[model samples]
Target: MKFQVRCFNIILLVLLLILIYFFFYHLRYIDDDGEPIGTVYITETRGRLDKSILTDYVKDKEDEYFSAANISVPILVWWTPFTYDTGSYTRCNNNNQARCFISNIRKYRDNKQFSAFLFYGTSFRLYDLPLPRHDHEQWSLIHEESPKNNYAFSFESIMNMFNHTATFKRHSDLPLTTQWLASIDDLLDQTYLIDVKEKTQLQTTENLAPIIYIQSDCSTPSDRDLYVKELMKYIQVDSYGGCLHNKDLPENLRNPVETMEHDEILKLVSKYKFTLAFENAICTDYITEKFWRPLKVGTVPIVYGSDQFQDFLPDNHSAISMLDFTTPELLARFIHELNVNDTMYDSYRHFKLYQIISNDTLLARTMSERKWGIHNDRVRGNFIHQFECLVCERIHKTRQDPTIKYQAKFDDYGCPPPTTFDKNGEKLERSGNWYRSYEFTRCQLEVFHELLDQKNYSFTEKDINNAATKRFAPSFRRNEFLR
Candidate 1:
């Protein structure tokens, strides 16, 4: 009886161990959406303050921040912009530097041996990723540009892959929100704003078209050219640049490249009553020079991009929303009405004309919240170097105490699905390989998880593509986006 009882206890112990393994290794692997975002290890701590001021803390007290004991010299790897530029990566040139930087993956083929991997969001292709992402090594996202890789990074499910971010999204660990503006002063500057009389005079004398749209990249995700072409039928537009060219730039500004560099571009654009400030891609806080140039030059912007664009506006009337109008013809009709009514048109420049921003939130955020500077900025340091330092310092902290870990939330890097309109221009289809790369990318994670368990699994681009194509793409429904 004693022998039988001992054997029964041993059997119970074995069953419990199996249950725990299945629960954690198999079941807990799923994210909230029930999708496996692949293998993960996270080692970074979020400061208990807003804006994750730990980045600013290290930057502010550099010497003091480095003196902590048992902090490992973490090697920070930049997976893209493969060239090592002068930007500070770890402790530069010091033998006991806080971190090291590398591009040659073969040198450290044991992928997770490094402490952190930073990916340049714009250039980092979905097809080409540093796979077998280990939770022990923190991942950092350095993308302040548009969602050109919407095929990969758009969905919230992908955010589970990274632990740090320096993007235009306000919720990012280090927000590069004001990338387009020269400074906060640029947004609030009234120094160059033309008065009502001057705008009227320029419109009459310069033969200024009601709206000016000068663009070089004709093909855009927004399909802006189609809208502009349709708008032209309803209103008189002086379209120049490469796309929809109906007018020539001034003799000196003939070279579009040179015109971009010329200070006169602002002066010339300001003469127009409105500027079509269409963006290349639509994503949150993806505002670029297209939006800023007009606002600064005193031209009312007909803006298209960013579903939450109004958050960046100085006032409700500061710019026209392309989304507001059902069709191009209707938008043109409103523009015509605004042109005739100087009171209505000039109201758009209220913030600029007065140099008084009623929107306190814009002032508060730009003045206080943002950590990175714009335009190779000298004071706050460029965002790239700052982001590298952020990864380095956080890795050190996490190494010293592994309990201090933080994961980037969905909002940190999430973008919506990219879609292209059909021939009817009414329906939207997903943008990707046969409009299916997004689906393929999600499926690729399963591949990553399987490959991750293997020792030193280095995937060729061809290997990844074939596996994802064969396993996933065929299952996707054709011509229709996955709902």
Candidate 2:
């Protein structure tokens, strides 16, 4: 009787373990109408924050079991530009940065390690090659069968609609209307503004100092040592702000640039009158945090971007002056004139305070919306078009070439390609076994317009005017926002 009871207990334990395993592995979801929901096996964590948990799931022996929903919300993954230039896999390996920056898209596109990049951020240089192909039209696999009983889960809506070059429609759809003006105001409220009187009370009047700020770091891909050397000619040796370079500095330089924590940097900005704001590259409207930090800190931002700085400023807002003169003698002379002329100096300050004080509410709203994984409003609808092009190319090529196989490589990214012309002036064909590098640039725009026009998503002159009035105006050339 005792032996029979022990055997019964062991069998029950094994059954309970099996039930728990199935429960955690399954993904359950509802349709847009909110009726019946069903379950499918989800191999990876779609929305969880734990990096290790997702890593373990992906490392499983059977990669086939891990399936994901076809919710093609224009997926965005951001990383510091340094990752691509050098193998900084140490920092990348810590937080699944490798997957986010590089591998995730490769996995999604069903290629071992190749992705179709439509729009990348400021730093990474682009390669001029046709997109690569994978064996599977993995995009269609998700749509072929619904994971749940009642609802049809299709990536068509997400991939087909969002992700365009002209607009970041994947992010938000708040019409660039007068009503959206409040978003920028809300952003300023959350800005870290140190009370002036309180800061003064902490420091001695004797120890009071000037500030010099640096924007980009020394290790960045676009590091400019010569630009910093030229800037030193204008500002006093004692004043500088922002993140300072770690490279060697001259001995005579009395005060080095500040290297504060991000929060501490904001706190220090409010206490100083002058903040050094330089662009990493010339003639690019790629404005960084340097544009706003000074305004929030109540300091005069010594601007160092492009000649078009005025385009980004609000109408009649002062508190900014450009680095106009080229020669050090001319620059030094102008700096002296601005400092002594009290009335002229005061005029620039008029628009400076309101940029931060008045627009507090709007600034807060903008920041909150940018916080990741909040609302899926389908801001733009071009990402899906690009994915569809890739999907079709993959399927079409497989039917043509039977022996094609996927190979992981880094050759396509960092270096520029050799000259396109062959000895006879015709373009050279790729040497790969499969035509993975098949060109498809001609028909993409036509397909995009067809889908958008079908959905009645037309942008009129009124839409352009409304967008310009609220947010910055769209510049076809710069691709950066200018007000």
TM-score of each: 0.74, 0.41
User: What's the residue-level lDDT of 287 in candidate 2?
Assistant: 41
Q: How many clashes does the backbone of model 1 have?
A: 5
lDDT of 1 by residue, 1-483 (tens): 999999999999999999997776654334223443222221111112232222332344335322221222455666654323212223422425455443322223243335777887766665566665565877788777776544456656567778899888888887776776656677776655776677778778887788999898876666677677878888998888889998887788877645653678888787888999888777788787788888887889999877777777777668998878877778989999998888998889888877766546553466566665665566665666677777777777787788998788888767665555433333255653323545677677666556655744677667767787877856765535454
lDDT of 2 by residue, 1-483 (tens): 999999999899999999887754332132223322222212211232334433453464245321232322222211211112111011111222222112222233332222233222222111211122223322221111101110111112223322222112112222111111223442244355444444344335624333345443432212233444554555552333224443332343323233332455566566654565654433223344565566555555666553445544433444454446444346545655754554564455554434543334332443344422111223322222222333334433444574653321221111111112122222223211111111111122233344345653444435433433433222222432211
Instruction: Tell me the number of clashing residue pairs for each predicted model.
Output: 5, 39
Which structure among the candidates has the greatest TM-score? 1
Report lDDT per candidate: 0.67, 0.34
Off by over 4 Å in 1: 1-72, 86-114, 125-131, 250-261, 420-456, 470-483
Residue-level lDDT for 473 in candidate 1: 55
